[model samples]
Target: MNAFPPAQALSGRRPAVAVWPWPIALGLLTVFGLLSALLGQHGIWLALSWAALSLPLIVTVICLVRAWSRPSDKGGRS
Candidate 1:
């Protein structure tokens, strides 16, 4: 017998975000990026904001590609 339940049973029809950390990190990054762009100092602020915005997008893309190419379920079920 299987030691754990089936993947679908554990998934329980939850949203994708429930299983990913990047979504929450990306959200926080976006909010901080916006705030930095609006309220931060001039020079460094632009750089910081751009990095904040782009880093998550790049990471998300990389993660998506990796996840797509891989055959295993590294992040558990749904």
Candidate 2:
């Protein structure tokens, strides 16, 4: 008999094909934000800096909300 339940059985599945595009994009935004801050302190540069910094913050809040709203596994934890 199998030691694990069918749902818990291990398999040699293929790895995920997903890429880190969002992280790379966020990093690029951070660099641009820094450059904008460095080059000047007014008008469009300020707007670009705020937007670049805010994008990552918005992403983080969205991820946190999704994670928090996801249902927890009843059988996995106390």
Compose the digit string of candidate 2's lDDT tens values, residues 1-78.
Answer: 113333433343333434778889999999999889789789999999989988999998987776566557333211
Q: Indicate which candidate wins on TM-score.
A: 2
lDDT of every predicted structure (CA atoms): 0.70, 0.70
Question: Each candidate's TM vs. the true structure?
Answer: 0.55, 0.67
lDDT, candidate 1, 1-78, per-residue tens: 112345644666533334456578889989888889899868899789999999887986887777677667544432
What is candidate 1's CA lDDT for residue 72? 75
Q: 40, model 1: CA deviation in Å?
A: 1.6
- lDDT of candidate 1 at residue 41, scale 0 to 100: 62
- True-structure Cα RMSD, model 1: 6.4
Clashes counted in candidate 1 amount to 0
lDDT of 2: 0.70
